[model samples]
Target: MVKDLVCTLKSARKREICCSRTTRAIIIDEPTPGLKSIFHIIILDQRSGKAEVQYQHDYVGISTCIGFNANPVINFSGVFGTNAFALGTDVAFDTASGNLAKYNAGLSFSTADLIAFLTLNDKFDTLIASYYHTVSPLTSIVVGAELTHSFSTNENTLTIGTQHALDPLTVVKARVNNFGKASALIQHEWRPKSLFTISAEVDTRAIEKSAKVGLALALKS
Candidate 1:
């Protein structure tokens, strides 16, 4: 059977802006022995009255994930009020050398208004491909690249990442980008469906000005 992964944030506050309550509801939760699928709807509303004029924005999104036999997962989600759409799929299988490999492809699209949305003229703006390989029981590596293009501008990036199991309860991941940026994440499994993580990033081009660190604790049911 499928288990709930995590709880969504209910409320957030900023220095000058006050956000309304965020809500999420599960629309579908069909579970099988080796297959699991879930669909959720989320609503977010924010308003600001600190300034002379008030400002507000509302967004609604539906997201879904499907997994079969714990491999070849497919995911697709779109935000309506935000004017964005995304879809992706990943598949894993055993290679001829007895190694495991997974491949992924994803596409994202956006539009200026709901009327012009999903049209072929200016819909898709980004495409990505990711490949992962398990070299050993304790080590795995991933290489991915993405391309973003429009009528007037284009950008591309490539990333190489690896994960190593330090012990039964610890895992480390590091990744490097073509744009002189690198990041590392270390996670410790405190218990079932609970973990602690430390993530950090550094920029080689501007070491002092572009360094960041974060810590997170997560619990899932």
Candidate 2:
């Protein structure tokens, strides 16, 4: 699993100080076979806002994250096993409101050549499934779909997309949903770390509508 944390601090006064500190400890070191756990604590103080504390824990097959400033929120996520088939769930609880704010679960199967995943998100109101396959050493494909149900509107929407790699440095992707909107993009790496991309979107139901086009370039130093 990969986790990213970002902190932003803004202050109008030049004399204000913004700082952060992180502490980590191994709480359990192989208490039993194949079992270990650690704790991480992060403290951030911004000049313009209150101090915030974040906690994270990781075990052999489980992980947890928690953050609180005034309203505390706790999150727990865990993967069951260390095999090709994996199951995981992410749940968030709001301590101030005494309710579960978010919950999501997923099951995935992976192999050397293929990966498949099915997930329930948005408090179980949304369902998503995806498949990825490596056709050859230099070519691969991916397909994914998302279905969402609105409780208030009593409506449903589905979107599906696929991506294909033409070569080591070029790729094309397209997606369309139950709606009339269709979009496609092609990206190519012109240099070792530079990329150019062209994308277009059109409403298929409205043949006379003008298509939207976009271009992007990225470079790395």
Candidate 3:
């Protein structure tokens, strides 16, 4: 399910802004069988600060894999919106430790999903840079790439190829236009179906003025 709404920030230091947060809850339907169901609750919130539940159901029947004759696995991926965003800053924090980012000396924390705030100039304008790609709902894969935009038009097809990996569509994130000036190109790498990433050198202020780099939440039943 996809829905959009407007949210006014009490302390918005930026104008062109984007942010996202994804949450999940899960439960096991049965645990003693060759195959059983695993239930999941998924939430997707967008730049507007509005959230929607996309799936509320059991994933494919589960089967244990081991000498014990059974194994369990859980999977979910949700993709929405643009990643090449403008930022006042993407206030990064170590959710596990509850420490907020200072945006200096490099943000050394990393995770599976994140929503970032970007800014250009001193206009208090924040660009929301998001990142996501499509893969099978339950299977895991390792994708890698370092490529370029390579083409353009009123509409452009963003592309990347693995420097060593063996997949063509290794990374996925659309080229997002910030303030009608330039597009921020983001590269991606997905591993084992649980980790999603985008990495590049970027100037939050120059996101709308020029090109830069940087770094999803998803669910399914």
- Backbone N/Cα/C clashes per model: 0, 0, 21
Q: In candidate 2, which residue pairs get closer than 3 Å at backbone N, Cα or C atoms, i.e. clash?
A: none
Q: What TM-score number comes out for model 3? A: 0.17
Q: State the weakest 10-residue window (summed lDDT) of model 3.
A: 63-72
Cand. 1 Cα-lDDT: 0.50
Query: How far off is residue 24 in model 3, in Å?
Result: 26
Flag the better candidate by lDDT, 1 or 2: 2
The weakest ten consecutive residues by lDDT in model 2 span 11-20
TM-score of each model, in listed order: 0.43, 0.68, 0.17
Would you list the C-alpha lDDT of every candidate in the order shown? Answer: 0.50, 0.69, 0.30
Per-candidate RMSD, Å: 19.6, 9.8, 22.2
Which runs in model 2 stand beyond 4 Å of their true positions? 1-22, 27-71, 141-158
- Candidate 1 at residue 220, lDDT? 92
The residue ranges of model 1 lying beyond 4 angstroms of the native Cα positions read 1-122, 139-152
lDDT of 1 by residue, 1-221 (tens): 53333443332221221222332333222233332233323333223211111122233333433333323333443433343655434333443434334444444454331111122122244444444455555443333333233433566666777777888788889888888899999999999989999999999899999999999999997
User: Residue 38 in candidate 3 has what lDDT?
Assistant: 30
| Cand. 1 TM to true fold | 0.43
Candidate 3, backbone clash total: 21
Q: After superposition, how far is residue 56 of candidate 2 from its true place, in Å?
A: 9.5
